[model samples]
Target: MFSSDILEATVTIIPLWDSVAYITMKAVILDGEWDPRPEYECSETEADTHKSNNGSQTWKHPALHIENREKPTPESDEVLVKVRYTGVCGSDISMTHADGDRYMHYSAYVNLPNVIGHEFSGEVVETGEDVQSFSKGDLVTSEVTSYCGRCHMCRNGFNGHCENFEQLGFTIPGAFAEYVAVPEILLWDVSPLEKAYKSKDDILKAAATIEPTTITYNGLFGRAEGIRPGDYYAFHGVGPIGLTGMNVARAAGAGAVIAFEPSDERRDLARELGFEYVFNPVETDPTQAVAQVTDGMGVDVHVETAGAVAQTYPAIDETLAETANVVHISNAGEPASVDLRQYQANAAQVYGAEGHTGDRIFTGVIRLMAAGKLDNLPLVTSIFDLEEADTAIEQASKRVDGKVLIEV
Candidate 1:
C-alpha cells in the first residue's frame, strides 16, 4: 500500500476581497511508476488487455506531495472555484496503492500525475467573461464527470453513460487544491444549504458530500426508481454512502432502515444516524436477520454499497420482497456468481448504476440538504487542514468512520 498518502480540503475562510485575484496556492498530485502483475501478460482476454492498458495492475511507490502546480484559468464557459472543503473517497486512495499492496481496485480512465479529489465544495473566486448565471462569491459544488452534453447518450437522458467523458481526479486535475476550474454547466448553487446549517463552514463541509451522496441517489432513485413511501430498506454497507443514503431513504419516507456492515464501528455509526436496526454480517446471517426483523416481509429496497458482491448479493437475493429493487452502487472489481432464478421468482428488478449525472441527481440532493432533511453530516467524523491531508488519508484507510474531510 502507499501508506494512505490521503488528500482532502479543510475549511478556509476565503477572503473574496474585490481587488484580490484568486490564484491556486497548492495541490496534492499523484505521480508513480506502473508495475503490472505477472498474470496480466497481455493475453487475448479482455481483463488482461484492460490491465495492460493501465500499464499494470498497480503503481510503484506512489507518492503524494503538496506541489505548486501551474494555476488553472477558466475557459469562456467555465469558472474558477476556490475549494474550501473536500471529502476523501476510496478511489482517491487507490491511486497510490502500489504493486506490493494487498489490493488495488481502481484503474479505469485514470491517467495519473493528476491532482486528487472529486468530492468538493467551494466558492467561485472568478468567472469567465461569458459566465452570467453565477458571480465571484457564489457557493457551489459541481459535477465531477466532465461529460459532453451533446453526445448521443447525453441527449437521451443517460448522460452518466456519456461516450465522451473525463473523470476528475482520474483523467484530469480535480478539487484537492486552492482552485479548480469548472465549466458553468456542471456547477450547482449550494448557497441554499446556508439555511440548514448554522455555520457557513459546516455548510461547505456538508456540500462536499454532494458527490458521493449522489452516487447512492443516482443508483437508488435514478436507476431503480427509488423506494415508495413506507417501504423497508436493507443496506449492505454503512459507509459514508450507506449512512447518507439511509438519510436519503428516510427523507423519501422509507418506513425502516436495516443496515448490515462487517465493521463493528460502521454498524455503530449506522445506529448513530438513528436507524433502529443494524447488524454485523460477519457474525449473523444478513438474510435471516432481515427476515426476522421484517417478519418475513423482507426488504423492498436492497442496496449494495460494501463492494463485496460475493457476500452482499446472496443476502440481497434471499431477502428480496415481491417486486423489490436491487441497486448496486459499490465499485466492485471482481465478478460474482448471481442467482438469477431468484429475481425471476420474486419479480424483482436489478439496476446497475455508475457516476452521478442526469436525472436531477444533484438538484434533489441539494434540495434535501437545503430543507434540513439530511443528517448525514454526522458522517463527517474527521476534518483536517490542507497541510495535514497526508494524515487524513491515512485515517480514511481505516474505513471506521462515516467520512473524513480536508479543510482547504
Candidate 2:
C-alpha cells in the first residue's frame, strides 16, 4: 500500500517496552476547555465537554503543538492506518488559533486535546480480527464524520446525520499522527489513484485531498440538488472547498464557473487551474460582474465558501438566478442578516450542507480523480513535514495559499 521510502519515513514501530512505549510518533494536538460565554448558548448536541453555557464565544486552543503521541490500536471492526499525508484544513487552523485570553474565533461541534486533522490518506498496516472489508496493505481514506451504519439516520438513508456522531480530528484522535484506527465501513479505497498518479507521494497527496473534494461534492450535488447542464454557477471563495467545487461543478456540466475571492494568491491559483472567470471580490462586485456576463439572467448555482456571510450573501442575493440553489458549506460562527425574501422572489432554495458521510460523495470524487477530471494535487501549494504540523496550520491560517499539507 505504501512505497518502501514512505514506510521508513512514516512508520516508526519501536520494540514494546514495559507498559509505556517510550518512543512514540509525533502529532499535532489542540487542547481546549468547556468554559462557557455569556453570549453563547449551549446546545443539547454540544460536545460532552461543552454542554454548559458559561464560556467564551468559542473554545480556544491554549496548547497546540507537534508532540509525542502513542500510536492507535484498531478496535474489533477497525483497521490501523499508517497516515502518509494529512491536509491542514481551515478547521484545524481555526482550532489552533487563540487570542491573548485564549478565546477562539471559530467553534462548533469542536472538542479538542486530540490530534488535529481530518483530511488524510494512508496505508492499512493492521486490521482487527473482525474487520472483513479492509486488510493490511490496503490504500484508503476515511470519512471525517464517523457514522454508525446501523443508526436510525443511516437506515433511513441519511447516514451523514447519524445520531452516534464523533468527528475525526474534532471529538476524537485524528490522522495528524503516524496512525489512526478507523472502522472499515467508513474507509474508501483510494488504490486506483496509485495508477493515476506518478509516484507514491503524489498518490498520497491526491488521496489526502479526496476528503475535501468529496465535501464540496456533497454540498453541491448531494445537498443542493447539484447543477443542471449549462447552468451558470459561481463560487464565492476560492479556498480548498471552493476550488474543488468549481472543478466539480464544471465536470457536472456547468456552462460557466466563476470564482470570487479576496486573496490574490488564491485567485491566481484559480486561474492557473483553467478557471477563466476569476475575480477579487474585494475589488469587484461579483454580483455586477456576474450580471454583466449572464445579462441579468443570474447564476443557477451560488456556492458559499467565503465564510464572511455578511460580505458574500449580498452578492449572492443580487446574482441568484431563478430557481437557483444556494448552498452554505462554510462555517461562520457569527450570524449575519439575510434577505430571506429573495428565496420567494427568485423561487430559489437554500441548503445547509455539512458532512460527507453518504450520497456516494467519496465514490464520485475518487472516480473523478481517477478519470482525470479533478486534479486537486495542484491545489496543494505548500507542504510541511509532520513534525511541523503547527507551521502548516499557521500557514493555512494566512489564507494566502491553496491546500496546505503535512506530509508524514
Candidate 3:
C-alpha cells in the first residue's frame, strides 16, 4: 500500500506491481498560480521543493513548461488513467496565455503548477480500493468539473453551478500527461466504444470529442428548455463546437440547420458535412438571409458559438423567430451592449450557457453517439503527438478550422 498527502487530502494507492516502484511521466505544467507577485516572490526553498517533486525547474511565473512527474497514484474513489488522446479547447488557449485579469479571474479555483488538459480519453490502468464503477483496462473519459454534492446548486440538480466546484485542468492536476488520477463519479464508461467503433483509435478519437459535444448538448437541451423535433435551428460559427451543434441539432430532429460563417474554409467544411443553408454573415445580412431561408418566419433556435458577443447577439436578435430561444455557448468575456428591443418585441429569450451538468450530459451525448446520431469524425481534422501539444494548441487557438487532438 502506498499513501501520500496532497493538498491536505490523504490518497491511498495499491501498486499494480507486487513491489514498490516509481515511474516518471512527461507532463505540461503551468509553473505558478495566478498571483500578482513577481516570479522572484516565490521562495527558493519552495521552488526547489517543487523541482525535486516534479523533476524539472522553471522560473517563468504562470508559464507552461514540459516536465517529468512521478506517475500519480489514485486515491480511494479514484482511478488512474493512461491517457490516449486529449482535445485542445478555446479555454485551454486562453488559460495558456494566463489571462490573469479577465478569464483567469473567473477561474480562481486553479492551483499553482497545474497540469492542464481537460478533454481526454484513456484506459484505466489502476483503481483505488474504494473505486467500484471502474476497473483496470476500462476505456473511459471523465467529467472534468467536479462538485461537492452537498452544495445548494448540486442538491437542486444544478451541479454545473455548484457553489463548490473544482475542475481537473484548472483547480488540480489534469490529463495533459501520460497518466491522470480522477474520481470515479466523474468517469464515463466508454468501453462500449470498443464494440461500437471500428478500431481503438476511432474510439479514442470519438471519446476525446465527447466533452465539447456535451457542452453543446447542455446548451441546447439543458439550458434552453430543450429543442423540439421540428424547430428551425441556426448556428453562428462553424468551428468545432458549432459544427457539433449542427450535428446535434440534426439528431434532435431539427427541421432545418443553418449556419453563419465568414471563413470560406469553414463554410465549405460545413457544406461538406451536409449543411445546405450556410451563409457568409460578412457578405449577406444574417437576418435577411435567415428570413429568406425560413420564409420570413425566422429561426426557432439560435446558437452563438462564435465568441464575438457584439456580433452574435445582434445577429441572434435579428434572426430569432417570435418565441424563439437563443443560447450563447461561447465565452466572449465581459458583457456586451445588446439591443434587447427586438428580442422583447419577438418575445424571445436569451440564455447564457456554460459547462455541462457532468455525467448526466455525458450519458446523453454517449447515447447519441452510439445510435449513430452524433458522428464527430468529420470534425477531428487535426491530430498531433503529445510532444506537439504546443503546436496543437496553436492550431486550435487560430480558430481557423476544426477540432485538434493531441495523441498521448
Candidate 4:
C-alpha cells in the first residue's frame, strides 16, 4: 500500500536506520504519501559515508581500505557483488609503476582513490530494485569494461570500444574490496561452473585465466584469415596466456602448436602441454628454430603473445606463410620500427588485438576442463588473501612462474 512519494522518502533514509520502528514508521507515512524532512534523509549508510570521507585502506588512494568504507550500495542498474577471487594481471604490474594509464584517459569515470583490480569472480549479494535479470546469491564474473550503451560502438554491439567506456581496475572502483558495485549488464553468472567442474574452486582458478585467454581468443578469431581445424600455428611467449593460447589453438583444431620461451620451467610446461616444438629463443635464433621445425615453409598462423620487444618483427617473419595472418595479442608499448621495403615482398597480413568480454572463451575453457582436455589446477603457482595483496604484488614482481591468485 506504499505510495510512490512515501517510498522515495523511505529509501532516502534506509541506509541510516536499520531498526524496524524507524523503517516501518517511515514506510507507513510513505504509504500515505507524506514526505520525510530533508534533515532526516540519510542518503548513505554510515559505512559508505565513512569510506567517502576517509580513504579506507593503508594504501588509501588506489588501494582499498575496507575498514573506512562500508560494503558498496547497488544502484538501480547495478548489482552488489561479494568478491570471492581476483586475478592479478600483467597490466596491473605496469600500472602500479607507470607514470600514466593510457586506457583510463579514454573513459568517462576515471577518478582517483579508485579501486583497481579487474580479474575477479563473486556472488550476487544484492540487486537494485529496478534490476530484473538476476537475484540474490548468484555466482558470476563480468566483462570488466563498463560502457555507456548509447555510444556508437555500444549501439553497434562493440561495447568494448564504446567512447564512454569505464573499465574496472583502472578508471572505476573494482573487485579488490570485499564487495563491489557493478553494472547489471556487465555481470555474468558463473553458476554453470557447478556442472562444468569438480567444484566451484576449479572454475574460480579457471576464471583467473579468462582475461588473458580472451585476449588470445579475440586476437585469433575476432580478426584473422580464420582458423580451421588442422591449421599449423606458431605462438610466441609461453606465459599463462601463451600457454592458454597453445591449448586454445589446439582446441580450435591447429594441427601443430609451436612455442617459444626462455624459461626452462615454462618450456617444460609447453612440452608437457603438447606443443610440437619448444624453442629457447634466448639460446638460439627463434626464427631459425621455427624455420627448422616447419621445413622453411612457415606456419599458417602466427600469434605474438610475448611482450618481448626483440620478438616483434621476427614473430611476423617466422609465422607468416605465403598468405598467412600474423596477430599480435599482447601489449608491447615500444614503437615498432619496420623497414617498409619488406612489406611489398612479404605476402602476409598483420593485426593488433586487445581486451575482451571473455565469457565465450571462459565457457570454452570450462568445457575443456570438463572434457579433461585442459587442466586448471596446474596453472596456479600461489594464492594469497586480501590483506596480503601488497605481498602478492611484491612476489609477482619476482616473476615466479604460473598464475598468482588473490583469494578474497
Candidate 5:
C-alpha cells in the first residue's frame, strides 16, 4: 500500500506498512516493507566496509558519499549485474546540482548519493535461484525501472506510468557502481553482442545512445502515434535526444529531418549523422528556416527536445502545420505560456512525453544498432572511470561535447 513520489527529482519515501515502502519518484512499491529497520547509526565496522577492497582509493560521495550501510540481497526474481559502463544524462546533472530547492528535500530523503547512472551495460554476475530467463555471465543492459504488471497503466502497456514503478537510478540504487541487482523481467541478454553489433565499441556506444534515442522514439513515434511514412519532421535542440530524433525521424520515413542546434559542434555532428539539414537557432530564425526548407509550410510533426523554456513557444511557432502534431519531450522547469486559441484554430495537437518504462524502446534502439542503421559511437566523445564521476558530471553539465561514458 505504500507509494513514493520523486517530484522534481526530490525523493520521498512513505511507509504504508511497517515493512513495505514506496518510492514517490515513480510510484513504485518495495514489497519487503515489513523488514525490520536497524536502529543503530554507522558503526566502525560498517564504516570500515565502505572502503574499496583495493584500499588505496580516495572516495568522495561518488558526488556526495553518504554511507549505505546495508547491501540489499537479491529477491528470488532478481539478477545481479556486475556493472561495466554507465552513461550520464542532463537530468543527473540537474539532480546533482539541485538547481533549485525544487525537489531537494524529497531527493535528499530518497535519491541522495544514489548510484546515479541509468544508461548502462553490464554482465550478469549472479541470478536469483528463481530467475529462469537469464543466467550468470550474460551480457546485458537494464531498462531502469520495475513496475507492477497488473496495474491499470501497465495493463494498457504504458508501464512507464505504472502506478507502482521502481526507477533504478532514483528509487533504487543503480548501476553507477560495480554492481546492481535488478528483477529478471528488467534484464535483457545482450550477449551475442556481435550477433547484434559489429564491434564491442559499437555496442558500448549504442548502449550510451539507446536511452536517449528511446526517449525520442517514445516521444515522436509513441506519443504522436499516427506519425506515418513521409511525414515532415523537425526537432528543436540537437542535443543527444534531438540528434537521436533525427535518426528516428528518418528511419520512421520522415522525408526530411531538420535539426535546430545552436551549438556549432552539435550542428556539425547532426549534419554528419545524416540530418538532411541543420541550423543554428542563434544565428537565424529556425521557424523561418523551416518555412523555407518546407516551401513555406511548417513541418507536419514537431518535437521540442531543447530543455529551454524560452525556445519552446518559438519552436512551436515555427514547426506546427495547419494540422500539426507536436510533442513536448523536454523537461524544462518553468511554466510556459501558449496561445491555446491559435493552436485550436490551427487544428494542432500537442502531447507531453516522459521517460520510458519498459524494454520496448530500449530493444528498438538496440535493433537499430544491430542493423547498422543508427550510428551511436560518434555520439560518445569522452570516457572516464567511476572514481571520476564528479568530473564526468561537471563535463556533462557543460554539454560542450558529445555523450560521456563512465567505466564502472
Candidate 6:
C-alpha cells in the first residue's frame, strides 16, 4: 500500500501485484454557492473505462479515476478557478495511452494519480492574499506552463524553456476537476474579449480553444517570419491545431492556403470551412499536388501539425519554396531521418516552434477573434459532460477532425 498527502490532498494506492494498483479518494466542494458538500468519494473501478463505440479497446492508460478530494487553497500568488470547460489535447491522449508508455517521458515532473487537463476556461472563485491582477468571478484562461521567473531561460525571455518548468496536466494537478489552483502570472482575463464572444456558449468555446490557438499563433507569428500577404501556406494536418493555423494564415491574407489530411472527415471539414485546396495524401502525393498548384514555385511557408516525422519531413522538404521556412510545431515523440542536404540546397529555415509566449500570444489571439479574423467554434465537434471525460478523450483520439470539449 502507498499513501501520501500533499497540501491537504491525499492519494491512497493499494498495490495489486506488480502490474496494477487500486486508488481512491474523497474530496470536498469548496465553493459555498455551488455545492456545500463536504465530501464525495471515487474509486479507480468507478472511473471511465476505455471502450469505443465498436466495442474495441482504445485507451492505454489503465486508470483515470475522478476524486472528490479536499479543495485546493491557492497560495499567496495563486487563485482558485472554478473550471467551466476543458479541451482534450493530443498530449492528454498520449499520457493516458497504456501501450505507449509516453508518460515515462515526463515521469520526472508529473505525479501520478492526478487530475489531467490543461486547456481550460474558468471563473475565479477565490484568490490568495498576494494575487493582484484578478478577483473572484473573473472569467479567465491561463497558460499551462508554471515557470520560475528566476530561471535563466525566463530571465532571458524564453520562459517556455525555463529550467524549472512545471506544466499543468503533466507536472502537477490540472483542471479536470471542479476547481484548480493556478499561479496568477499564468492567468489571462478573457472578459475584455467578450465583445467578440456572442454568448456564454460562445465564450466557453473560445476559452476551450485559447491554448491551442495561442500555440498556433506563436508558431505563425513568434517563430516564423509571420505570414505575409500573397504568400502561399501549406499545412500537413487538419486537426484542431492545423485548422487554427489555416484560419490564422487566411486571416493574415495569405495568397493561397492548402492542406493535406488523410482522414476523410477532416478533408470534408477543411472544404466546408472554405479551404479551396484540400487533398488526401492517400489519393495524391501532397508534395506533387502543392508543386502543381503553386506552378512549381512550392509553398512559401509549411506548417507540420501531424506528428508523423517520416511523412512531414519529406513533404515539407519537397514542397518548400527556395527561401521559405518550415515550422515544425508537432510533438512527434520519435526521431526522424531527414536529408540535410535538401535544406542546405534550398536555404530553407526550419524552426522548432513549441508552446506560446504565455499572455502575449493569448492577448493577440483574443484581438484576432475580436476583429473577426479567427473563430474556432466550428471546430468543436463534440462536447461531453465532465463525467464523461474518459469517453471524451477516447473520441478525441480517434480519426475525428475537430475538437472535443468536457463541460466541467
Look at candidate 2 and give me any clashing residue pairs: 35-55, 36-54, 36-55, 36-56, 37-54, 37-55
Count of clashing pairs, candidate 1: 8
Write model 3 residue lDDT over 24-76, tens digit each, in one string: 78998765543333433444644544322111122224566888778998998
Q: Worst ten-residue run, lDDT, model 4?
A: 25-34
Error of 5 at 181 (Å): 0.8
Highest TM-score: give the candidate number: 2
lDDT per residue (tens digit) for residues 306-383 in model 5? 867576676676467788888898877568777677688778888899876564676776677666677667777788
Give all TM-scores, in the order shown.
Answer: 0.88, 0.89, 0.85, 0.77, 0.78, 0.82
Worst 10 residues of 6 by lDDT: 28-37
The full ranking of all candidates by TM-score, starting with the best, is: 2, 1, 3, 6, 5, 4
List where candidate 4 sits over 4 angstroms from the true fold: 1-68, 98-110, 339-346, 358-374
The window of 10 residues in a row where model 1 has the poorest summed lDDT is: 3-12
Off by over 4 Å in 3: 1-22, 32-34, 37-61, 98-109
lDDT of 1 at 341: 94
Model 5 is weakest, by summed lDDT over 10 consecutive residues, at: 27-36
> Please, what is the whole-model Cα lDDT of each candidate in the order they appear?
0.81, 0.82, 0.80, 0.65, 0.67, 0.75
**Candidate 4 local Cα displacement, residue 211, angstroms:** 2.4
Better of 1 and 2 by lDDT: 2
Q: Flag regions of model 5 displaced more than 4 Å.
A: 1-63, 66-73, 100-110, 150-152, 191-196
Candidate closer to the true structure by lDDT (higher is better), 2 or 3? 2
Rank the candidate models, highest lDDT first.
2, 1, 3, 6, 5, 4
Q: lDDT per residue, candidate 6, 11-113, as tens digits?
A: 2343344222212222111110111112323223222321111101222233576555667778999999988889888766655554443112221233345
Q: What is the lDDT of candidate 5?
A: 0.67
Task: Please give the TM-score that candidate 2 achieves against the real structure.
Answer: 0.89
Between candidates 4 and 5, name the one with more favorable TM-score: 5
Task: Report the C-alpha lDDT of model 4 over 327-369, residue by residue, as the tens digit.
Answer: 8777675666554444445667778876675336556655665
